[model samples]
Target: MALMITDECINCDVCEPECPNGAISQGDETYVIDPALCTECVGHYETSQCVEVCPVDCIVKDPSHDESEDDLRAKFERIAGN
Candidate 1:
């Protein structure tokens, strides 16, 4: 599943660079994660980098974009053309 930034996000900008997929970006107020490009760091790391770096713990699973491990891997490969 892709990770999401909740309203609790302080817009610290700490988690933006941590995302390997480059899915996290600044929104109007708080930062946001792009579900289409997000892979939850599946092929890049053991866990979601955004979640690992978020100070406010605002990063959480995006229920609307729920995906399985296999699906995440496929998405990764598709984007990366691997």
Candidate 2:
């Protein structure tokens, strides 16, 4: 599944640069995660780099954008053109 940034985000700016897919960005009020571009770092890393580095632990699976492992990998490949 894709990940999302919660309201708990402190706008620390740590998570944005950690996202391999460039899915995280600063929003009007807080950091936001783009489900369309998110691949949970499946193809780039064993774990989500953004989540791994977020000090606030505000990143979580996007329930609304739930996806299987295969789906996530497909999304990664689609983004990577692999």
Per residue, candidate 2 scores C-alpha lDDT tens digits across 1-82 of 8999889999988989988899988899999999999999998899899989999899999999989999999998999999
lDDT of model number 1: 0.90
Report lDDT per candidate: 0.90, 0.92
Q: Note each model's CA RMSD in angstroms.
A: 0.7, 0.6
Clashing residue pairs in candidate 1 (N, C-alpha, C atoms within 3 angstroms): none
Candidate 1 regions exceeding 4 Å error are none
State residue 34's C-alpha deviation in candidate 2, in Å.
0.5
TM-score of each model, paired residue for residue = 0.96, 0.97
Q: How good is model 2 by TM-score?
A: 0.97
